[model samples]
Target chain A: MNPAYGPNPWQQTSWDARAACNFVFGGVGAGLIVFAVLFGAGGLALKGLVLAGLALVGLGLFCVWTEIGRPLRALHVFINPRSSWMTREALSATLLFPAGLAAAAAVPGFAWVAAGLALAFVYCQGRMLQAAKGIPAWREPLVVPLIVVTAVAEGGGVFFVAAPLGGGGTPPLDALLGAMLLLRVLLWFAYRRRLAGTVAPPARVALDAAGRLLQLAGTLAPLVLIALVASGAASGAAAAALMAIAGLAAALGGAYVKYALVTRAGFNQGFMLARLPVRGSR
Target chain B: MTRWAMVADLRRCVGCQTCTAACRHANATPPGVQWRRVLDMEFGEYPDVHRAFVPVGCQHCDDPPCMDVCPTTATKKRSDGIVTIDYDLCIGCAYCAVACPYQARYKTQKALFAYGEPIASEAKRHDDARLAVATKCTFCVDRVDAGIEKGLQPGVDPEATPACVNSCLANALTFGDRDDPHSNVFRLLAENQHFRMHEELGTGPGFYYVWDKAAG
Candidate 1:
C-alpha cells in the first residue's frame, strides 16, 4: 500500500454541516432576491437584494473553500475556462451581479431580462450539486431540474409572504404563485423516481419528511393564490393567510431538504478504513 | 484565437496539491478561494477501497453555460474560445452563481482596493461601490495578451501559468491550446484515456483526466 495515501482503509470525510450552511443560506438569500423582482420594485432594490443574496452565497462557498485551502486563488478553475461548470458559474456570477444592476437601472424589457437571468443563475446552484458524480443523493439526474423548481417555487412563496409586509401587491401575483406551486408538485413527482433506487436510507427518511411537508404546502398554495388573484374580489385575508402559510411551508421544507442532503447518513470511501478496524488486526 | 486544455495522467499525479497551491500564487487570489481543487474520491466497500485524485476545473466547452446565462453580456466568449468576464460592470446579483453546475463564481461583499483599503468599510466614501460585485478567474487574459504581443503562444503566458498548472509536482498537468494539433494539450487529448468531470451536462469542458488502473 502507498504510505502517502494518508490514512487507509481510507475514510471519506463528510463535511455536511458546512455544506448545509452553504446550501440553506444561499438558497434562502437567492429566493428572497428573486422574490423581490416579482413584486413591483425598481431595479435598484432588485440589485441590492441580489447582491445581498450573492454575499450570503459567496460566504457559504467561501467556507467550503476554506475547508480545503487558500480562498484567494479560487480563480485557477478558469485556466481552461471552457468546459468547467465552476468557470461557467464564475463567469455567470461575474455578469449576473452587474447585469442585475443594469436591469435595475434600465427600462422595461431590460429589467425582465435581468430577472430572467437571475432565474437561470439560481438554476446553476442546483445543477452544481446535482453534477457531483460521487454522492448518490447528489448524482440523480432529476436533482438539478428539481432544484430549479424548488428555488423558483420557494422564491415565489417567500416573495408573496414578504410582499405585503413591504407594501406591495398586484392582481396576477396570486396566479403566479399557483403556477409556481403546480410546477413544484410536478417536479417533486418527477424526482420521486430517482429518489427510490439511488438514495441512502437516512437520506430517504429525511426526504420523505420533507416531501410530506411540501405536499401540505402544495395543497394550500392554489387556494391562496387563486384568492389573491381575486384582488379583494374573494375570500380576503383567509386567502392571503393561506398563501403565507404555504410559502412558509415551502421555505421551511426546502431548508429541511437542504439540511437533510448534507447531514443525512452516507460514507465517503476514503476515510472508512481508519474508522473501522480489521477483523483481527490492530 | 487560442483554446486552452489540460490532461492529467492520474497515474503520475501524486495528489500533493502542488497544482492547487501553484494556482493560488499564480493568480494572486485574495483568500478562501481555489481555482483548482484536488478531490480524492474513494470508492468500493469497507475493506476493498480505491482512491482517485480528480483535478476538476472549467471545461471551456464548445458551448459554455456561463455565457448563455450572463444578463449583461459581461461574460464574453473571445474568438479563441476563452470564456472571460468583465469586472467593472458587475452588480453582484449572483444570478450566474445559481446557473453554474460547477459552483465556480464568487460574489465580492467588499472590494480589495489599490492598497489595503477595505472597500466595504469605506462604503460611505465610495457610495457602496465595492460591496456589490462578482469576481472570478479570467484565465490570465493579461498574460495571454502579453504572450500574444511577445509573439509567443497565445495562452502560454509563462509568468502567469495558472497556479495549478505550475504546481503539478509529478508533472500531471499539461496546458496548451487544443486547437494546435502539435501542442502538448492536444497530444495529451489524442493519446490518452481521457474523461471530463460531469460530461453529461455537456458544458464541453476543456480539462480532461487520464485514468491509470495500475496506480489503483
Candidate 2:
C-alpha cells in the first residue's frame, strides 16, 4: 500500500455518521409507513403512524442537509435525474410526502398510494448506496436487496413494537416478521461471502462482527419471540411485552448493521498494478 | 475532435518528485491534498527485485463516475475530454469524492496554509472559492485555453504544457492531443507498450504509463 494521498487502503470519510443516520431513520420510517398501511391501520392509528413515519423521514433528510457544506444550494440536488441516483431520491421525496399526508387523513385508497411511494423512497435509498462504484462494500450487487429487505424487516419490527396503539399484532403480521428476519440473516451471509476478497481486512472484521449481532439478536431472538406469540404459548400482556421486546431488537439490530455498512465498511477501491517497471531496462 | 492526454515513460522516471512539487506549486493545493500522487512501489523479491514510482490522479475518464454521480451537475466534461468541477454550482455534498475510484477528488472546507499562516507567496495565490467544494486536477485547462487563445500549441509549447510535465527532469512525462498522430504523445504511444490504470473499470483513462519500450 502507498502512503497518505497515495494508494493506501483508503477508507472513505466523505459520508460518515450523517449519512448513516439517513439510512437508519429513512429506511425504518419508510418501512413503517408501508407496513402500517399493509397491516390495515385505521382512523387515528393510521394518521398517527403515517405522520410519525413522515417526520422520521424528514428528520433524516435534515441530518443530511446539516452535513452538506453548502446547504443553501441543496435544491440543486434535484438537477441530475439522467445520471444520478441522488437526484432520483430527491425527486421521489417530492411525491412521497403528499401521499403520506393523504393516507394519514384516511383518504379512501390513499393509504395504498402512500405505501407504494414509501417503497419507492426506500428503494431509491438502496440504489443510492449501490451507485457508489468506488466503495467495494456498497457497490456489490447484493447491496440493493440487502438494504431493501432489512428495511422491510425493520418496518415489521416497528409495527409489532407499536401494536398497542393500533389494535395489536395479528398472527399473520407475526409470521411475516419471522420470515423477513430469516431472509435478512440469510442475505447478509451471502453478501458477506461475496465480498470476502474485495473488502479491506478491517472492513471484513467489522462486517463479521455486525453479522454475528444480526444473526443472534436481530434474527434468532426475534424468531423465537414471534414463535411464542404465534403458537399461543404467550397471551394477553405477556404476548404484547414479548413481541415488543423482539421488535426493539429487530429495529435496533438492523440500524446497527446499516450504521456499520455506511461508516465502518466503506473502504475505497485502491489501485492494482499488474506489472512493475524496472529502473534501467532499456 | 481532440482528446488531451498525458504519457508517462516509467523506465525513464527516477522518482525524483519534481513533478509532484511543481504540480502542487502550480495549483496551490491545500495541505494534505495532493491531486498528483507518486506512489513508491517495490516488486519481485531478493536478487530479482524491481522498483518503480507509479503516478496516479484524476484519469479524466471518458465515462467519469464523478460526473455521473454528481447530484448538482457540478462535475462536467468538456468536449476536449477534460473533466472539471464548477465551484459555483457545487453544494459540497462530496458525493463525487466517494464515486471516484481513483480517489482523485478532494473537498477542503477552509483555507489552510502550509506554515501555520499564509506565507508571502501563499497569500498572493490561494483561491478561497475552492474552499468547501470538490477539487481535482483539470490537466491545467486554464493554461491550455489561454495558450490556444494566443494561437499557440498546447503540448508543444513549454508555457501551455502542464506544470508537472514541464518540470520533469527525467523527461518521462509528455502531454498532447492523443488524436493528433503527429503529436509527441501519439508518437510515443505508437512506439511503446503502454497501459492505463484501472482500465478494466472501463474508465478509458487519458493517462497512460509506457512500461516496455520494445513491445511496440
Candidate 3:
C-alpha cells in the first residue's frame, strides 16, 4: 500500500517494464522503417533492419499481452479504436508489419508507405503516454514530442550500427545521428523543466537524475564517437568500433528513459481534499 | 436524467467510521481493499488544533479519466451517472486506478480474509470475477437500481440509499439526484456552501462537500 502523503494512494504504476518495452521497440522499429526508406539500403541491410524492427514491435506487443490480468481476452484491445489510443497503436502495427515485409522484399512502393505507418505508430505511442492524465509526468504536453524525438534518435543509432555491419556505410548518417542526439538531449531538458514544478518532489528528482544520465551517456557519448570518426582520429576498425559503441549507448539510453518514466516516475496525481478541514468548532 | 450524487456535511460528521465498516460488510471486499474510508484530518497549530473527519470514496465524475483510458472499455458510466467496471471485461491493467485523481479505484489481485482464515462470510460474499480487476464504490448501484425498479427513491429510502449514507450515525452523508430540484442533494447544494475535490480539473465530480452554512 502507498503512504498517505505520497502522490495518489495507488503507488503501483499501471505500466511496467513490459509496457515500456512496447514503446521502446515500437519506437525503434518505426524509426528503422524510416531509415530503410531514406537510405534505400536494400539486400541484407534493409531486410535485416526491417525484420529486426518488426520483431521488436511484435515483442513489445507480446510483453503487453503478458502484463494484462486476462491474457485470453487480449484481442479486446482492438475493439475500442474509436476512442482508445491502444487500439489505434494496434491498428497501426497491423499496417506496419505487412508493409515492413513488403519493404524488406525490396518493393519500392511499399517502402515509403511503411515508413509513414511506422512514423504514425511512433506518434501513437507518444499519444498513448500523454493520454494517461492520472500520471502528471506522463500527461505533460511535451511528453509527446520527447517520445517521438527519442524514437528517432534511437532509430538513427540502430542504423549507424546496422549499416556498417551490412557493408553499407554513409558519411551523412554520422551527421544525422549527431543531429538526432542533440534534439533528444534538448527535448529531455525541456521535458524535465516542464515537469519540475508539477510533478511530485521524489518523482521530479528521479526524472532529473535519469534525464542527466541520458544526456551524458546517450547523447554526448554518441556525438563524441561521431566526431572521432569525422576527425580521422579513428579510421577503419577503430571508427567502426566507435560507431558500434555509440549506437549501443544511444539505443540503451532511449530504452532506459522509457523504463524510468513508466515504472519509477509514474506516480499518480494523489488525493486532493477540496477544503482544508477546519479545526475546533467544526 | 437523474444524476446521482453524494453530499457530506462537514459540520455534522463525527468520524466514527461506521460508514466504512458498513461499506466493507456490504461489498465483502478483500482485506486492504476499502471501497469507502474516513480520513481523520487535523489542521492548525498545536494550541489551535482542530480535527475534521472526511469520508472519501468514488466521485463518479461526468468526465471520468478512468473510462477514457481503459483499453478494454471495461469502465462505463450509467445514464443516471453511476460509474461501473465490468469485472469480467477488465484486464486489471490498473490504468483506471492510476487515472482516477481522487484515489477512488482499488485493484486486488488475490482473495484474502480479515483473519488468516477464509471465513464463511468471506466465502459467501467473495466474488471471483473481482480478482485482479479495478473495484470502487458504485454508489450501491445494485440497491439503487432495485429500489428504483420498485418505485422507491434512492436518497429518500433507507434501503435504496448507499450503505455509507445509511450507516452514517452523525447523519452527515446525504445521497440524492443532483439534477432533481426536489432531491435532498440539490436542496443541500442550494442551501449550503460546498466544494468539489479537484473541480478545476473539469472532471465534474458527483460528490460535494458542504463546508459552511453562512457561505451559502
Predictions in order: lDDT? 0.57, 0.85, 0.82
lDDT of 2 by residue, B104-205 (tens): 988898899999899989999988789888999989889988988888888899788888889989898899999999999899999877888767677788
Query: Which 10-residue span in candidate 1 chain A carries the lowest summed lDDT?
Result: A273-282
Q: What fraction of the true interface does each of the listed models get right, in terms of native contacts kept?
A: 0.00, 0.71, 0.47
Q: Which tens-of-lDDT digit does each residue in A1-282 have in candidate 3?
A: 211221233344566888878888888878877876776677778888888888878988888777777777777777677777777888999899999999889887887888889888988888888877778888888999888888878887787777668874567887877888898889888888888767777787668777877988998888888998989898877787788788878988887888788888887666555565342334
Interface RMSD (one decimal) of model 3:
2.9
Instruction: Report model 2's chain A TM-score.
Output: 0.95
Q: Which of candidates 2 and 3 reaches a greater DockQ?
A: 2
Give one digit per residue, the lDDT tens place, for model 1 in B33-96. Answer: 5667676766567899866666655555566666654445556677766677666444343435
- Angstrom error of the Cα, residue A91, model 1: value is 21
B8-115 per-residue lDDT for model 3 (tens digits): 998888889999999998888888877888878765678986667888889989999888878889989998899999988888777677677777888776778888
lDDT of 1 by residue, A166-206 (tens): 44445576677667677776777777666675444555676
The two-chain DockQ for each candidate, comma-separated, is 0.03, 0.62, 0.50
In angstroms, give how far residue B89 of model 3 lies from its true place. Answer: 2.2
lDDT of 3: 0.82
Model 2 per-residue lDDT tens digits across residues A1-282: 422122446689999899888888888888889889988878888898889888878888888888887888899999899999888878877788999998887788999998888888888888888888788898888988898888888988888888876767778888888988999898999999999988888889888888889999998999999888888999988898899899989988898999999899888867766555545656
TM-score of candidate 1 versus the correct structure, residues matched by position: 0.52
Every candidate's CA RMSD = 11.8, 2.5, 3.1
